[model samples]
Target: MAGTAGSGSSPLSAGGDGDDSLYPIAVLIDELRNEDVQLRLNSIKKLSTIALALGVERTRTELLPFLTDTIYDEDEVLLALAEQLGNFTGLVGGPDFAHCLLDSVRLLAVEACVSIAQLLSQDDVEVLVMPTLRQAAEDKSWRVRYMVADKFSELQKAVGPKITLNDLIPAFQNLLKDCEAEVRAAAAHKVKELCENLPSEDRETIIMNQILPYIKELVSDTNQHVKTALASVIMGLSTILGKENTIEHLLPLFLAQLKDECPEVRLNIISNLDCVNEVIGIRQLSQSLLPAIVELAEDAKWRVRLAIIEYMPLLAGQLGMEFFDEKLNSLCMAWLVDHVYAIREAATNNLMKLVQKFGTEWAQNTIVPKVLVMANDPNYLHRMTTLFCINALSEACGREITTKQMLPIVLKMAGDQVANVRFNVAKSLQKIGPLLDTDALQGEVKLVLQKLGQDEDMDVKYFAQEAISVLALA
Candidate 1:
């Protein structure tokens, strides 16, 4: 039994043996000082993995100083040093070991520059990593500086609120203007994070003076990616601000994106309206955002139109029926006939809400005729929504519209190309059964229920059975 277990632990086997190997540890420690960069690196990696598996405390008493020294050894060996330090520092060294750890971090943070920042980030061990990070935020290398901006973000979460905002805030502000676009992009994302959780007063001050100006400058950045990042930050801040008690200062920036050259940016800008309305007042929505919403309602991009549909109800509350009188009502009506199934579907749902809000006059004037046309659409989804829309419109207008106008259209859709339509149309006719004074279309309605009762989809089959049961009760 002992020999069988030992066989599984053999290093010569491709599979990892479960047995402890003490020989590799001593060999790697000796190779750590090797002049050959590759030999030292491979040795350091082996030792680091051993330390990770064994314990950092076990490795630290022997390996800490050597890892620190390697950061300045040469660029070729720096990566090896960084990887080892990441593993070593992350271990449970505690406060008593802070001096050796802090000293090593200083060299990486200030002098070794870029390589050290990568080390600090790679390990991201808050206890072993932050002191070096705090110092390196002042590094002379733009690459090092950019890296610090990123590490500060990760460390801030790990370190909690211990590091002063004063230390990180300026570094990020400077990074926002870095000559490298990649650095600028990274800094923008970091700054956005910082602003989110920064103490409320501090965040407000930064928004008023620092962040807002930086965003305006960054929004027009020649780098489209940077502009996109800035746009996202603006949108996030707008949402945060929209919920904040004090929002007078943030509204202008939120509104500016409505005209952004990028359609996506414009869409994000509009999305913040509800938040803004929640914070400021509905009047700001009615007065400031109406035209942009109208323009977006007709947007060539289906996504942008979808966004408009999402916000239209909010705007309607502020601007009232006058806003949708010609602009929104007519646009959705036209969309009901759209070739895109999603657009047609969205139009049907929104029209249901619209009829519910404005009643039959609005449905008759704006939606009823178009939805009736869609009852025959080729797209299965479109046909389903069209039938659902007629049912919804009848409910919105009461049974009078069902008896007077919609029953024939509902019966016609009972044989729709899609199964859901066949089910829903039958179900919709049953809802109007008690309300129908005459049996003018009673035979057609019976045929719909008969066909639906045998539908393959269980939902259709059940609703069809219910429709038949209701007809029998009548």
Candidate 2:
């Protein structure tokens, strides 16, 4: 009954004879009532084609009601409608078409909202679409509210600048403070893109008025995920707000984030330090950022400490040699004795990055001495850390230092009581051996390999034999 022709003459049948015969809108309309889903879908497809052929007036009079009737149908039917709805824009006009489609926004279906946001023109959006969006932005369903926040840009473009400033901004602000964390995150995530497109004066005005006030509350969001989303956008805000403004306003928020209870939020801030550095420069980072880095280096979560290790080179590169000599040097060395082996391993692995940055001369004078002290450390893990450092730094520190100074440490560790230390010694020798220049140094390496090859531990023996074969090939 829904798709049936009314008592009066059918407007759909008035098309050219050849077109009507080929499509037969009446038959397609009848097919819509068929129990078979595929048949109903085919009818919808054919109806879309007929709607296009019917021109604007006929499409409005004849086709739109049938499509609108199926608006509450199955998802596949709704998707098909959403796809074809844009085709009728010229016939019904943008505003009228948008209004017709959005009549069902409160139905809690995402397809209609997504389709309308994507398809409507700039003019239509300002008029009919913006009102629908503003209403949908506060839909009782959080998911429906998410759809509005997610598609804010598309809707923003529809309304254009004038309505965006007055109407859409208020809508976005409400969504930002939405009771749902997801809705709040969705709004926060779009803040950067919103500011990036505006003029400098407008960007400043929005930040000073709209953004800065909300930021402290956002950073302190009870949801860790919401805090993370805000963390990701801080640099963009800092860049837009400029150095002085960022320090005055944004930096306090960043400092507070470093003290957040969630390690992830703290980790997010550390990971984006380079972005922060881009705004505030190394001088500010040295003062504001260094203490946070030092605190995080000893974070209770090993994963958090591992993240700090991963970011060591970034901090070192930004802080420069003076900071490295004064602060980072001691911090990196302390990682050798970290309670977690994985943290120690990462610290050892990352040491070459520091060596490469500061150069071999500085390394030989500064880092190498400390590493040598760790090699003979009472704790076997520190010795293992030393072996890992030697393997990592071999090529970078070059043959002269690796063979003369570093090799003796490897040789001593080869006879270490711990199988882990001995295995790593074989591992370090394999990396360090090929860098040796003189026959005497090669012979000394071979002697250590021979001693390790006979070790009681099978893993050490396996690694030593493997090292022997690798060095022979070299």
Candidate 3:
């Protein structure tokens, strides 16, 4: 009798003391077929309440089919139906009949189901949530499988270790190799998080035996986005697996990814070098690392180049001055004159960090001269970069080096043809002033700032006067 519902009225309309309370259910059912989209969506959202009033058997026979029929409703309505039905397994005669509501979750509602799976009994989770997840993982639509992959880490935590190992692992491998690039990319992105959440006793074994081969496959995935996604997290496995396994298994994948055709994939590998360096040491990595690093430092993408410059001090400490000068030192200096202002700015800071790492004497011998020579570059921007470099290097290089090696170049640049160079030179003196001895500040720096204070350019003279105030050289 209740099966004849959704025609026009709630089944409770027949006979009940609660008919007055159930009047809203009739209105909700009536609204389910309403032409207005939000009305139908609102009705779908309260579906669990309607099912509760209708009782278990009627919910199964009436509500399930009505939702199935309304699958063609507006996407928002269907999305709401998907969310409501995920929690409906309990309302629809419990776990045995959870299967009748399967299409909603397997297709459009996978995320909500993961949240509800926690509320199920173990038997129900295996019976209801696991099978639904298993099928969703293999669903015909890439979007469904993608939903499963995106939430795979959350699903792993929900199902506990035994189910995750038995059911989710095999499904996960298929997802990582999914024919659609989007699904594979989603799975590739979860590799670190999935490995991280695996049971501690089995975490290493699972990553090495089960997860890694697919990860290796992903490292060369024909899709750049997949490789890029994997590159972002793959270095993380080094910490999870420990040094020996990382050196043996992961190092090769990292080296390969470092040379990946896509700049983002290559950039991702470079950015996370510290992850591997902490585990196996960077000297052992230097052979392959240097070439890929050099290639990325000069990469056509400015962001890629920027990532390498940021990582230079870490690379410098790991490889040490001998190897760094032999290989990477020029790459650091090359960045100072890089066409992109952001790159050049990072390069200037990089010199300061390098001076801190390698000390002032080596900077005098190595970095200081190159920065000083840039003052004479044909491009006025490079001359400005020289002043930027001095500002950064002053704190690290100290008073002797700032006054002796660095200050003369800054003072000389004050007379440059470009007002921008002159203004930055004034800013640089204010920055480096505290680093200079009183004799240098009073005699040389004061005179140069006084000369710059009278410049025709407003910006140059404003900064020149500001520098005099900040340094108290007025």
The estimated TM-scores of all candidates read 0.63, 0.84, 0.84
- In order, the Cα lDDT scores of the candidates are 0.61, 0.74, 0.83
Ranking by TM-score: 3, 2, 1
lDDT of 3 by residue, 127-188 (tens): 76776787788888787788889988888887788888899999999999999999999999
Ranking by lDDT: 3, 2, 1
Report the number of clashing residue pairs per model. Answer: 1, 0, 0
Best by lDDT: 3
Candidate 1: tens digits of C-alpha lDDT, residues 1-474: 001222222222232334447556645655655666677667656755656654655445534544444334554455445444544445635434433444543334433232233444333434454556655655555556666666556545544443435455666677788788877877777666777867776667666576667766776787866766666666556555544523455555555667666776776666555556666665555566667667777778887777777666655655568656745667767776666677776776777777767778877766677677766767776776766677556767666676667887787776666777777777787776766654543566666777777877788888888877876733
Stretches of candidate 1 above 4 Å error? 1-21, 24-49, 52-58, 68-92, 102-131, 134-147, 151-165, 190-192, 201-203, 235-249, 310-327, 353-370, 373-388, 391-405, 412-442, 447-474
Each model's Cα RMSD = 9.2, 4.4, 4.0
Which RMSD does model 3 reach against the true structure? Answer: 4.0
Please report how far candidate 2 places residue 410 from its true position, in Å: 0.7
Colliding pairs, model 2: none
lDDT of 1: 0.61
